[model samples]
Target: MLEGPEIHRALTRIAHEVLERTKGAEDVTLLGIPSRGAPLARRLAERIERVESRTVPCGALDITMYRDDLHLAPARALGRTEIPPEGIDGRVVVLVDDVLFSGRTVRAALDALNDLGRPRSVQLAVLVDRGHRELPIRADYVGKNLPTSLRESVTVLLEESDGVDAVLIGPKRERGEDRTDEARTASGEEN
Candidate 1:
């Protein structure tokens, strides 16, 4: 539902909100959940730098191994998790992601973060909050609050990986429904 310009505006706004909430974001470190979230984290850092004139450490945090539903799916290739050299200890960490759906991914990310180091506090920032949370979690910064059905899926395409920036909403395949790899990815089933 969101186009390139809209996404940029959202991220820019989120960057400002983060700075305001963190009181200049001097000790803030952004950890983006892999795939779409990585590039988003970089963009936010850039925007934050532009306004605050200071660089914010941004890195990728892969939650593949931390997911509770790992056994439900087949073996998957692990995503890269890179922590900034400054580290997350004693810092305010903001977890960035493309879409907040079931809240499971954010849960997995929290578990992964615990293994890494203890942060002073943790917050969430998302491009879209689809409102189907299965956990007691919420995002501190949200681009859009999209109402969607369980049978619907939200896909975020970033220019860094997808070569385009857009958000698409479509039907989700039901169990036993024949699904192709392309369809699965498009439906954000893999996100």
Candidate 2:
């Protein structure tokens, strides 16, 4: 439903919101939930720096082992988790993600964050918040609030990974059917 320019504008707005919410993001550390989140976090950091004239720590958080549905799925490759040297302790951590659907991924990210270190506070930021939350989680900063049916899927394609930036909505795949990673993410089967 969204194209490249629109996605860029949304990210720009989200960056500004993060700065405004955190009062300049002085002690904020953005931890992106890989794979798309990592790049998104970097982009946010860059935008924040451009506006505030200071660097914001950005890194990737891998939630593979912390997922609640690990037993239900087959073996999966773990993504890289890179924390800045400053660490999360006493910092306002913003967990960035591509799409928010059932909130499972965000929950998994929170669990993983707990194992790492204690943060002053934890907040969530997402490119698309396609509601149907299975958990009580909600995003602190959202690029778009997309209302969708349970049978439909929302996919976010980023330029860093997908070579094109777009938010697509389509039908969910049948059980055991082959689908792309984006489709899997939209179906709330992966993050």
After the best TM-score superposition of candidate 2, give how far the Cα of residue 41 lies from its true spot, in angstroms: 0.6
lDDT score of residue 50 within candidate 1: 100
- The count of residue-pair clashes in candidate 1 stands at 1
Over the full model, what C-alpha lDDT does candidate 2 score relative to the true structure? 0.86
lDDT, candidate 2, 1-191, per-residue tens: 99999989999999999999999999999999878889999999999999999999999998878878778756566778999999999999999998898899998998888989999999999999888888999999999998988778777888888888998888876643553454335334333
Name the best candidate (by TM-score): 2
**What's the true lDDT of residue 156 in model 2?**
80
Q: Give the Cα lDDT of each candidate.
A: 0.85, 0.86
lDDT per residue, candidate 1, 106-144, as tens digits? 889999989999999999999998897778999999999
Worst lDDT window (10 residues) for model 1? 179-188
TM-score of each: 0.93, 0.93
- Where in model 2 is the C-alpha error above 4 Å? 175-191
